[model samples]
Target: MNNALEPSAVALGTAGWGGGWGVEPLDDGAWAEAERVASDALAAALEAGITTVDTADIYAHGRSEQTLGRLLAADSGLRERIRLQTKCGIMIGGSPLYGVDSAAAVESTRYHGGADHVRRAVTDSLERLHTDHVDTLIIHRPDPLTRPEETVEAYLELASAGSVGSLGLSNMGVAWVRRFDDALRAATGGEEGIACLQIELGLHHRGLVESAVLVNHPDSADRAVVGEAGGLAELCAERGIALQAWGSLGQGRYTRGTEQAADQDREAAAVVAEIAGRLEVSGEAVVLAWLLKLPWRIQPVVGTVNPDRLRAAAQAPVAADRMDSLDWYRLWTAARGAPLP
Candidate 1:
């Protein structure tokens, strides 16, 4: 916590608070429960010095935004202490059977990558979040058909107009990130650059490392990769960029009660559990501590509506360096069920 990197800025992901994305929907009673859970989680997060949150408009069909809005409205002081980051571009439609709408489905049928649409979506998100300006605004994903310059220009315009404090991009390849970074720099008269790049990085998903090699593209020196982001630790050392790690717990596959917990998962969990017991902590604390041990600045975006779990996660990094290299690799190999070459 006292490192040069401000781990306290670790963000809380609100995707689960809205209860979407293959997760159970929150009924009226569940919504009330979520409010209490979120409130308690937020209280604990604030107390633990975690003051940033990452939410998305499409999460739970805007339910996440609404819930966050309500929470911030209830406590104005909390609003000031925290920095809100939300995404746009992904569209979702209302539904009855699926609880809320599906953003991916909506975009597939009626996708428009225009500035007007971007403005309208951000405005709606701001309304739901009950805030005038978002600390960070990211495009959930780039439209394959849209021009990079056009999208970057739109984001630059928003920043210039003071609608968004900073602009970021998500789910983009290394080429796209560099292209947008250059385009935005030119469009903004070199006044601003990308604040961050959000991507999925964890023990199981090391694709970012392979992708970084492709982004470097020795064959295309003219198109060098810009805006460095990779494995949480590597990226931190290379570019001084913050790593916002999503799915830090492998989407709950590592948990004890989940059906996705296979033998490999159980074995990995056992290793985590043993380490936790030795450290006098929870399994989640051990997983997070491992993440914190990496050289980079990682802010795991954990998505749980449970306050107790949130508190435990906040304390996970307390003994980051206690685990030896062999133990770390043992857990890593068990999690992968394979040895490194």
Candidate 2:
């Protein structure tokens, strides 16, 4: 990945900013407070050297991007320092997440990857982001109806027009990635393809790692993570694409939100706490460092909007540097809640 699109070891996720997902309805004053929080979080991210920020169009029904845009507009230098990434594909309709009431909101939300949808989505995203182009534009989800060729054509046009720097995929399988890349190569007759793949990965969810370790187990394939069916991590490494881990902090199950953790997860939290004590770092740092120990160089997207937490999580790389293999396995075994089969 070029410097323009290359992400830091840690990325900032904006899902919690500007009235993010699952948030209750907020009045105008409450929303203003949310924006203020978002601004502080962005400043914290920059201070911690987090170069990339991830968001989706459906996030806060565009408030997240609008908030980011306003921040970028206010500080001309901020736009030059940070790389912006946003996703499209899932079309949002009336939903309580956006403070809208509709009985069929779930039915109203659908995925579209047609040429028209891709073009319009990027164009609209650019307008909301207050940028002429995005550092990376990811497909938020797989669109069963649209052909891969249509999506690739749209992506190429956007890249050619200088509207998108790189392409990425999220919540997609290896087969889908191959189809898109194959179409891209056939059209361009070169090696250019996807630049990154984002998926949910953390101690709370070890399906990606389990898929590799449980080779002969009967339930191995069934339990495989959504994007790990065909060795997705190895594939991304071979193709020179970055593997980014969303939900990398495990929703604070092992850290701040232990009160709501299940019994099994509580056990894992204990193990994390042990490691954190030995290392003299916060539990959040240990959790993120565990991901950094992976050979694939997985980029953990820290979703917390709290500046203090973000600064703490940013120390994960340093923690990983000091963590030995035995310590890494100890945390893994606790999360698995059993010895390797």
Candidate 3:
């Protein structure tokens, strides 16, 4: 968190910007091309008013951070203008993984966030990112092997040394966040805590919002948010932890007009499309605005290289200006495929 302000609304995602990610992964040649495209996209994104870029060490097996490093190295001035946030903890093998379904295997990376591993991870990330300090350093996943107290001690050490600023989490549960935060506060004596919660949340995945909307229904068969109390969302709201959403535009499922999630997306995208048409904005903007209307302000992590798309995404808050409260629920229900009980 290099003393930079938090990304106000939306952040550009560099997951696909690196090389190997998304529906179809790339090869060596394709990866080179991807780096070129991403560098160009990053320039366009900064010019388009996006100040935050989210990436991870495992992304493209570190090519993501390396590519970003190259860009930053070339333009020393760009370093100050933008905030760099990268994650680690998950490691990737040499194999080039492709497609969305197969991409899940990458998560199986052994989660190791002990003092030694966090120290090594941060050092390696800084080396790859080619920066002295990152605006925010995130733990990609919880390490079952290490206790929260032990992990936060190393994190606090980094923060004190200015090697890292704000701490973060990804794909983590509520209990874990609480444990980590408790440990962090104990270590710092209430001086610092998690800066944000990055999770898979959007029109395509409403687990965070669904828990609140579902109330005490306790029905997991119909919705993914029903199982637990979804204390994370509540905690984030109460604690003022900004909720940053990944895959906010359905990850091309909605905007591409592709039949990625045909049955489910058909109805959801229809409502979003109708709204976008009425508002005269891109479909991506509409979906994003819907997420923004949640109780907490959601910072969207969008992966788009096209300059036009980046600017269109920046218009999310404005596109939402035309939406009424009723229309907001309409979009939610459409995505849920069922009216509120």
RMSD of each: 6.2, 3.3, 4.4
For candidate 3, the lDDT comes to 0.78
Which lDDT tens digits does candidate 3 get at residues 62-139? 678878887888787877887878887775533242123445545454666778768877887888778888888788
Each model's TM-score? 0.80, 0.91, 0.89
lDDT, candidate 1, equals 0.67
Each model's lDDT comes to 0.67, 0.81, 0.78
Error of 3 at 138 (Å): 0.8
- Per-residue accuracy of model 2 over 1-341 as CA lDDT, tens digit each: 22354578899999877766543566888778877999999888889888899988778877788778878777877777888889988877564432343345344787878898789878978887787888888998889998888888898899889898888888776788777767777778866888788889898777778878777786675665433454877777877778889999998988864566788788888878878888888888899999999988688988899999999898888889888999999899888878877
**Residue-pair clashes per candidate, as listed?**
3, 0, 2
Error of 1 at 16 (Å): 1.4
Better of 1 and 2 by lDDT: 2
Q: What's the residue-level lDDT of 35 in candidate 1?
A: 77
What is the Cα-based TM-score of model 1?
0.80
**Residue range 1-341, candidate 1, lDDT tens digits:** 11122335357888877555533456798778767777888888878767778888778767788888888788766667787788877654443212334444553333335676677777888888887777888877877777767777776677777667777777766566666667777887977667676777665554543334545555224323233343333533454446677887666666554245776688777777777778777666677666677666667778766676777777766747577777677777777665543
lDDT of 2 at 233: 79
Instruction: Assess the local accuracy of residue 102 in candidate 2 as a C-alpha lDDT between 0 and 100.
Output: 30
